[model samples]
Target: MLPFERIITIDRESKVPIYRQIAIAFINAISQGIIKANTHLPSTRDLSKLLEVHRKTIVAAYDELEAQDWVVSVPRKYVAVSAKIPNLKPKKWMDEVNESAYRALFQLPFKQIVVPKVKSNAQLPEVIIDDGFPDVRLSPIDDLLKIYRSYTSKKHSIRNATFGSAQGSLKLREVLASYLSETRGLNIEKEHLLITHGAQMSIYLAAQLLLAKGDVVVVGKPNYSKATQVFEQTGATVVEVGVDKSGLLVEEIQAICQQKAIKAIYVIPHHHYPTTVTMSIERRIALLKLSQQYAFAIIEDDYDYDYHYASSPYLPLASSPHQGNIIYIGSFSKLLDPSIRIGFMVAPFNFIEQGVALRKLIDVGVDGYMQNALAELIRMGELKRHIKKAKKCYFSRRDYLDHLLQEHLKSQVSYSLPSGGMAIWIVLKKEGLVEYLVQHPQLAIRRSAIELNAFRFGFASMNETELEQAVLLLKKIIEGFELQGVKGQL
Candidate 1:
């Protein structure tokens, strides 16, 4: 056992709140590495007695530390060291003001910027089939709370609360290094992982890191809309490449790169967003080759690898040998709950340091306690078990939705049965189906789609019963469209 140093020193005369002083001291110790990772410290009672302070005071101090992600707490037992010292700083006032100005100007009511009205109801439906949100009903809340409680009872050192190193928690990186290597066959070290808020943030960071204004990036047509928006926000010219049953047409991507100076290609190969079509292994290899030949990067958005229902799920595009040009993005949002907000980017070892630096500038580090808890979850094999349970649940829902679609709206609408992922993209026989449905007397909510003819339905969020009702309602809407006899434009 490591020697327990006197971690708490209180000055009653100091003007600073006891809690704030305690938080500062804890951060200092963590920075010096005096308190190591996973090291369980004395209980709050023991620490209060040792420091001759009231237990309540220590509790308050510890609460501050926990909020900052410096320590982890367990009920009535002990607290544990969860993260290392973070190296972060507050943004300059000028930068903040400048950003605020830009947003204000951009958000000024403009014709091109279509802002949707907020929903009036405070309570959303329990089963939301239209929104592409992962089902969080089956998350391991008990285990998470247990872990959270375990880490919060100790006295945090000064080092632990300070800004962390940009790469994120070392323990998280270490665990993800092994997890990705084993599960996805991607060879990466702790140094190669840069943790972010989620895959969306990963996309934004990759754009910030790799792209400059006026750069060209090839994206799949009818791609993840948010990704396209991110690229556009970065002032990059987005060129859409058509996707077939196999995947993005590699030859078309090649032709685009040949014709223009392409910076990167953003794609979801394992299960494409909205439309869950796995890119073929041959196409994956071809994409890597194209990137190698064209001297561009491939941003592989491997969003839903955990719940694959196909006989053989498509391998990640980054799994193959390439010239260190693949920026592979993964997230825990789909596997676990979106509230977890932990995702990672796997890049070449050389890019790790710079990426971490950029990440620090972006969000400092992600919540340290969550990262530590996730590390513990991964270490104890709880994560895999949760994923297994989720896969079964989602697959059942997928089947239920498919059955409902076939039974009701068979010939009027067409959809590809997805092997995995949270949502299915559907194409209606008539254009403007979404408009027509929203305008229906019964339903008043409007939605946006990539095309007037296409819309996505997420099966994961709804249970069998809720799904049955939603499909029945949707079928009625489709039938109405058929009755109208809308023809394609000449």
Candidate 2:
């Protein structure tokens, strides 16, 4: 008989329950062939006595083993290893397993592994100056939950509750069609829309469907990092053009078009990411004409378009009368909360059909109940009301942050108050400040996607009180550098 005492060791301090620990030890022994299949396991009472554990713990562990088909219990006989398990070679214990051993034993099946574009901290700080995230406190979460409860309780929900249309809840698509057409002047219907997990997923679906090897996708120099990454993953070549205060330099794009057959051109047109520069109408019109002339798709990402302050928001280029070959992506995450992963894509019905098919490959659809809840909100005009209330609140917060920045770091940083969007692009006037902020133990901020002397100050997530706290902390960090500067420090 095996030395069962030596085989099973217990650490009472371990977080794993004793029963689970016992079951795991047996499983390891069985899989390693230290205990062969069809071998009788010690009776629960004997093992409990040997291990000095409660009889109940041993019974529970045996039950666990039986449930997993690792052992079978005979009628008034004994428990034995299941005959089903194939003969596996004896292997070293867990502590002895290393990378080399793992490679020798197992195969790494994935052809490609995804690498994240940004490095996220293990945990976020309590107070955050986020990268253009919406304030969750301002989202109409209670109302949304109330509506969600109503739909799930209704008996007909069973029928509508199953896998919804691949494009998402038809109710949501219908409501969004009306809401967008009314608000953004998008001439679209449910057939032209595909609801997705979020804008990133929408962008990814568009890229996978439209781009392939040897294809070329155009983007601005200082563009949204994730969008560029998605386009590149399709094995297509990504071509960067310059961006100015007016947004993507169309002339450079036109120059690129003359040289190569451009497959798609990505633009954040309204309050562009990282830079926060809105494209002029002239550029919008020129790009539309070029797309018609050159036969390339336009991926228009109009995130946070509803929160404009300085002027009336430009209706998306897709709203144009001649709009075609444009794939428009927008997010409800900004209106609701960042955690609420609801976004939509708008294109011609034919393009939308293919997008829905591709979306099914990744996921069946977005959460049906949540999608229906949102549809209810839009139908009752509650969503619009919430947006109106939150927009005003964020507008005030944006101004409050503007005032704080001007008061505190006026000398150290230079920024243009954006016409619209959640963040202000502030360029650090002096060198080494960005690196200093990065290395600071207390500060949590993202480096800009574009390698520039700038960073985005997302004020929308922070309130006046929180903004005051953040700016003061930043002021201290900057002033420490100022003192160092006075000493002609390295």
Candidate 3:
């Protein structure tokens, strides 16, 4: 006889009735072949005694088993297992076949997107200094959360589950129209604005809408790689323009315009990537005038316009008197945190309408409640106040990092303190210096070789202690190279 006690343990506290537990256990045992077909089950009275339950509980368990065809009544006043049982086998082979067939037939040709590899947030190095990234520690998360919850709780507001406008929450657009006019000198209405996941999305939308195969898209030589990838995906030929201390050489771009029918120009005029050199006022004016003369679009990616440490930064080109044919995009990712995917595009209403149709096809719509909460943050001046406080903290950090670099790395590399953005570009006196540092496991910072001699360092995310450690590591590496006398020519 099979021992019932060892096979099944009863949980007196379980919400499932005691009898149901017994029945389920027996059924599972039969299906698993632990209890074979045609086996005799103990009598109800005996089971009652064995299980320490009332005889009625045992009778209920037996009745359940009989109903499920696991056991049946016998003429000898005994219960016997049903002759037939469910066939139980692992479906591994079947699953593998289905997956293989799907993979062969259902895969899309994926285009490679150029994305910068950032250190994982889950496990960061003890000391991390990189191109400027926002410190989420300083984000007004609690206030944003409170605002989100408030909007969600209001039953009348469509901030709950309803699909929002593809152009973005109208409330957010209204707030941004006023906000951008005051802050960046851009006079635009809500209708001209299209909210995006980030500036990248805005760039992609503009590329798909404005560009054609073999069309020319101009970019700086060491430009934002991701934007380059976006333009390439739209089948546009990317023409590289030279960038100097002032910014993109407008003359070079003008030369290209004369040679080819330039469809658009992608620029990060405020703090150019990897170099952090602000575009000179003259170049800004020239680029604007050229855009008019050539009849090409201007895709201005103003990613980090908020963290200016020196005198008030120059107003964006979109705010300039010559603002036609411009698709101005800005991101809240830098202001709040990168994870908050909120960016806005300022363009003509027709362009926005086209972007909305494309956005719906891709993303359907963004989070309406979150956008509304951000709007409230702007309306109440919480975001503005936070930016002011954060700018001061970042200014101090930037100056400290600059001092550390001068003290430790002055002999080995050349750099200029950036006027506005989060990073400093350092031209190394030696080649392969960065590749050597990358091999070590302890340090992680954004390093990119500029020309054959320089690399960029983004310092906005690091604190004083981390900055100190990073500078010390850099100093040690250069010393190690000197001690070994391992100098390589570029």
Which candidate has the highest lDDT of all?
2
Report lDDT (CA) for all predictions: 0.75, 0.85, 0.83
What residue runs in model 2 are displaced by over 4 Å at the alpha carbon? 11-17, 63-79, 82-86, 92-126, 447-450, 485-490
TM-score of 1: 0.72
Deviating ranges (above 4 Å) for candidate 1: 1-127, 155-163, 438-452, 479-490
Using lDDT as the yardstick, the better of models 1 and 2 is 2
Residue-level error in angstroms, candidate 1, position 37: 59
Candidate 2 per-residue C-alpha lDDT over 59-120 given as tens digits, one digit per residue, 9 for 90 to 100:
99999999999999996799999999889887654443212234463465755747755545
Candidate with better lDDT, 2 vs 3: 2
How well is each residue in 50-169 modelled by candidate 3, as lDDT tens digits? 989999998898889998888888755789888786545523222222122345754778767667555444455555556677878888978998988887778865634255688898
Candidate 1 per-residue lDDT, tens place, 291-342, comes to: 8888999898987788788764556778788878999999988777767788
TM-score of 3: 0.76
Q: What overall lDDT, based on C-alpha atoms, would model 1 receive against the true structure?
A: 0.75
